[model samples]
Target: MTKEWMNWYRETLLIDAHNDVVSKMKDGGLDFCQRQSATHSDLPRLLEAGVNLQVLALFAPPDSNKSVTLQRILSYAEYALDCVDRDPRLHLVLTKRDLEALSPAEGKLGVILGVEGGDCVGEELWILRLLYRLGVRLLTITWSNRNALADGIWEKDTRGGLTSFGKEVIKEMEALGMIIDVSHLAPAGFWDIAEVAAGPFIASHSNAAAVCPHPRNLSDEQIRCVADRGGVVGVNFYGPHLTEFGSASIDDIIRHIEHLWNVAGEDHVGLGTDYDGMDIVPRELEDVTCLPRLVEKLRQRGHSESRLEKFMGGNFLRVFKTVLPD
Candidate 1:
């Protein structure tokens, strides 16, 4: 048998469900193909970090305090796709096969193009179809503020439910086989989606509200809600999300994982470390390469190797496999 050390650092594929690498890459004055990384993640760093799948968000913060036009919206997605298409190393993915095709040597990283907010398309459903056709696999209904699609966690959800247009958007995404992401949706919007989204969905980069009082997390009921629908909640590793005082360490991250796993069951819990998206991370999980530390920690916490494997990668992969279109 191989030494325990040999299998200890298992080549488990790490997938951070949300990363702002594309935009930050742009900020570093590097385009997709040209991104050499002066910042958090680059192609080389991702490989060094032992990542299998990296979700690159097409985030274009509105130029105005409120970006109220379709023309200005989706520019980031359009450009990000162009960047991906230009780089043979990056493959835009909308289906499971696209993910299966990734090769590190080829610099071919699996990129699931996701829009952070549906504000770009306004109330029109056609834009979703266009975005899907453009290779977007996931859509977060809202970001920090309310929009035509849904209310964001930052905003007070006066409506207390999904709007009529939001329901229609969900249907379109369902028909198109796109995954509905609820990271920033308000409580009302969250439940509204649970009722309408036909297929299972995910909170791509959210934590348990019980762990952190942040508006961005799923409440205990919300956690159960997503799990009941066969969806996974990728427990976030952001320091703020994992700690109640917002004072945290990697241990806090583990607590949330253990908590979510215990509450949501093994199959429905996974990691969605919102790298680059959050300013603060647990001290132990400082960089991508430090992920193995988390595995060892989980082992100490009485999580069997099998459970660790599932929590680390298997769960997210399962969700992705289930949600990807035929």
Candidate 2:
């Protein structure tokens, strides 16, 4: 890597919008504080990546019992909290003030909690508030199946959008200053969020459907809606999302970014490396430590420093400060 890129990587407020570290650790009985080679995230690796802020997704399987899922997720949250408490290099970011005070240069990894599916809240809106109190500032309305709020990509055949409860959830989330994540929601549900949401909402870990044509990927129009609403579209690094084939390389990732930058504009693009959440990753980006290499590649591709900064973390940081409550 170039010295200039290394300096920028260390100095910039690098934010990864989505990662499934918590769920992976819980399922695999892994330790977050140790150097884990089998997984994509660990305290030491994240810190070494110079990750200023990382959103660790707390996901429950869609078919699981809602109450049980919530309890398990809470336990996972507690474990993560305990880990943070024991380690001085880790900080759990619960408020906008915490985010504002973050200085990655100080070597602390500011961690944010995101729920991958709203199913954990069951049919009760109050449950959403309860999760918010527990430090989950971002909520993905669905996973790959139908839920109380809306249908996921798997339910696209219904062409259904958000239900009455889904609209209510969006309203309450906005009032509470929690970010509405539309990553797994079906296209119809995505449009529903775009229409009902008065403020910005993000596709926390989606790529360009126009490029890869995956059901999980966003179309050009959807990308524009996100940008138009001043929300960021975090680019997912999973190979399946990046290409028609199952395998992908760094060029494929750059291709998605180039397309997203065109469709959504520079201000709305950011990284959402779905690390530990996917089985396959681009060869060039094997783990979090390879993030700087991607930056260098983007630079070589002719992205200006300012645009690179936005794509790297500035865009997501802007949304976080706006949506995260005090």
Candidate 3:
């Protein structure tokens, strides 16, 4: 990498909207504070990659009962807190002020807690409130299955959208300053959210369906809707989402970014590499430290410094600033 891009990358406020390291910690006893050769990211690797902010997801298997799911989420939250407490360089981000306090030069990794599915919320708004009080600032309404809130991408046969409860939950989330993630929501549910949401929302870790034709990827219209709402579509680095053949490399990642740039505009593009959440990742992007290579490739593709900055992290920071509480 050239010195110019490297310097620019270091100075930029890099943010990833989604990661599953917390769940990995909960289930596999993965150490977040130490460098782990088995996982995609850890404290040392994230610092080396220059990631200023990382949103760790609290996810439970969709099939688990409400009680089990709630317990699992709480356990993950506790573990994440423990990890933060164990590492002086890691801080939990709760408000806009906390986010603004992050500086790449300080080598502090600010963590924003989020939930990958709303099943833990069950039919109660208080559970959601509890999560907020616990420092969860983002929630994805569904995973890949139907829940009390709405149907997921795999529920297309049902043609289900948001339940009345789902609409209420979203309104409550916005009022509580929690970001709404629409990554695994079905098309019907995605449109329902667009209709009900009064503020910007994000597809936290999804790619472009127009490029890879995967259910987990968003369509051009979906991308446009997110951009129109002043929201962002985080490019997912998972292989299947990036290529039809289920194998991908850095070039495939660039293809998705290019498509998102054209369809969603520069302001709506960001990185949400679902690291530690997937089994397979794109070649050359096997871990967090490879992020600079991705940016270098974009630079080679003629992306100007300002545009590359947006794609790298600026877009998500703008949305977080807008959506997160003061």
Candidate 4:
């Protein structure tokens, strides 16, 4: 490939680590949920952007009662895949072979399911097994509220971090080959996970707390812990997590990428555009189609083409390769 074509390919190989497309699609309910032209991430946009791997999140807020939430999220995931099945051009990856089968030649976009919080399990181990069986590969222990598993960073009590139940949950996920996600976990909760998590894991959609100071973001120590553990951190697009100053811009986004690539190293840093979850995106890097511009910025900064490829989607794919069961 020519240098120009190589740059084009490098810029577009995105693996958006967290997206609420399914949850948003469910807002319209079963009957009226077919059209995705309404959201930021529809099948067409992802393909148009050449997004190679899409992490579709089964996101439920803290209050979603157990039995009801899991059913809804799983149902939403199934429905999302249903759309892909109907489209002959779309490819939804569920196995190692399916991942290998995809190429830019065969509609590069590949969908993977992730649960954004453990509250949906509702103290039921069966739910974890079931969700995994149903194709959930990444599971977060908590959202912004305390749960049977762990305290969220936003939990008011903050008295406890990971409860006794949380450890079991982590172990269960480990044995099942599911990636433990620490994005919204409390500080102590993060440590508990870092200590006992038997396999590779990640903070799917978070930024450096040292830069942003938001409870939702990870501290420098937290970033280091994840990196040292051979894990990756997908720096979030949300401005609140990206900065303590004023409104955010593309520069803020690049700087965070620079900082994360510096601190976490290029192998351990990637993108988790919380596109549908946040009201705003970084300037210039607005939607799925705009992601290529980021690669240009990285190139202008003198990032090698190969390292930039890892940042785009290679890092996340590497983690998935480790966590996905044979």
Candidate 5:
């Protein structure tokens, strides 16, 4: 890396809104603190990439029974906390103040715990509260399947939106100051959230469907809704979401980023990466350590320093500042 590039990266408050390293760890993968060749991210590489904050997702397969899912989530949450507790370089971010204090230059990696699916929540409001108390500051309502809360992208043909319980969950989440993620939610459910959510929400790890036409990617209208609410759409690094052709590359990622920027405006775009959660990634962005290359490419594509900052982490920081607890 160039000296100038290193300086720019260190000075920027880089944040990745979604990563599934915890799930990988749950499945006998390497710990986040260790460097690994088997997964997309780890602490060593994240530090090398100057990632100031990383939101680690607690996800279970959608087909698991509710009780089993809940158990798995709890275990993941515990493991996440343990990982942070054991590492001096990592800090658990639980409030807006914690987020505001993050600085990549200070060599600290802020960690935000998030639940990636609501099936584990079942029909309970208290469980949601418990998750908040346990320091989970974000929740993705569904995971490409129907749940007590709502239908996911795979169930779009059913025209299902938020169930009554799902509406209540949204309200409670807002009351608790937790970020509601709409990534895998079906179109009906996505609109339902736009109608019920009184604050900005995030499509944490989704791309623009208008660019790639994947079911998991958001449509132009969905992107506009998120931007209109002063929310942000995180560009997923998963290849299928980036291209209709064979394998993707960093340029494919840029294509989706440009599309999201045009549709959602500059301030609404950010990176989600979804590392360790996907089977394949763009060749240039194979791991977290390659983040600087992506930034360099964006810079080469004529993105100004200020716009680069927003796309890197500033925009997401603004939303977190607004949505997170005091």
Candidate 6:
């Protein structure tokens, strides 16, 4: 890596828009404070990668009982809160001011809770309010399955948009200053969100289907729409999303970033590694500690220091300032 790239990375506040480490932490009875080979992230690995902020997803798997699933999510939130309380190095950021006060120089890592599926809310707006009270700042409308709020990517046959309840939920979330994430919402639902969102939204962990033809990936038009709405599209690093082939490398990731940049503009693109959520990752970027390797490659591609800074995290920071509650 060039000295310029190294210095820029060191000075900038790098953030990953999405990570599923908390799920693994809870499922395996693992501790976030200790390094484990079982997951793609740990506290030490985050520090090593210079990650100033991370959004930990609170995901609930599909099951028969919605109440039980929500209870499990609550347990996860408690675990995350307990972790933050015990670790001086970790800070849970609930508002814009908290994020602004984060000090990487002091070795503090800013953590934000994001609910990956609105199904966890269980058709109750009050439950959504409860999650906000519990410190969840980002909410994905759906997660590859139909929910009371809307359809996910896999529910294409329905071609349904947000339900009546979904519209109310969006308005309420916006009023509460909670960010609406569109990563797994269906194509019709994506447009529905665009029509209703008064402020920016994000695709926390998605890639360009134009680059890799996965149904899970966003189309070029979707990427452009995200940028047009003054939001950010975090380039996903999962192998299947990065390429048609099962295996992907850092170069494939770079290709997605390049395509996103070309379509979404530099200010609207960011990184959302989706670590621990995927079974396969790019060989070079096997874990959080290898983030710098991608930076080095971007430098080799001649991305200016300013552009690189935005891609690293500035874009999301800007959105946070705009959308986070004062």
lDDT of 1 by residue, 153-229 (tens): 77754755578999999998888888888888888888889989877889988988787777777788989888899
RMSD in order of candidates: 2.9, 1.1, 0.9, 2.6, 1.0, 1.1
| Residue 105 of model 5, lDDT score | 84
Clashes of each: 0, 0, 0, 1, 0, 0
39: Cα error in model 2, Å: 0.6
Task: Write the residue-wise lDDT of candidate 2 on 133-168 in tens digits.
Answer: 888888999998999899999999999899999999
Compose the digit string of candidate 6's lDDT tens values, residues 1-326: 77775666777888899999998899799999888899999998898888999999988796668988798889889989988999998999889899788655456789999999888898899999999999999998999998899999999778999999999999999999998899988899999999998999999999999888898899989999999999999988888898888799999999999999999999999988999999998998999999999988898789897898899989999998889998
Query: What are the per-residue Cα lDDT tens digits for candidate 3 across 1-326?
Result: 76876877899889999899888866887788889888999889999999999999989997558989999999999999998988899999988998788887578899999999999999999999999999999999999999999999999788999999999999999999999999999999999999999999999999999899999899899999999999999988888898989989999999999999999889999999999999998899999999999999888888898998888788998889888999
The clash number for model 6 is 0
For model 5, how does the per-residue alpha-carbon lDDT over 262-306 read when each residue is reduced to its tens digit? 999999999999998998888988789899999999988899989
Number of clashing pairs, model 3? Answer: 0
**Ranked by lDDT, top first:** 5, 3, 6, 2, 4, 1
What are the TM-scores, per candidate, against the unseen true structure?
0.89, 0.98, 0.98, 0.92, 0.98, 0.98
CA lDDT of each prediction against the hidden true structure: 0.74, 0.90, 0.92, 0.78, 0.92, 0.90
- Cα RMSD for predicted model 1: 2.9
List the candidate 3 regions with Cα displacement exceeding 4 Å.
Answer: none
In model 2, the runs with Cα more than 4 Å from the true position are none
- Native-to-model Cα distance after best TM-score fit, residue 159 in candidate 1, in Å: 4.7
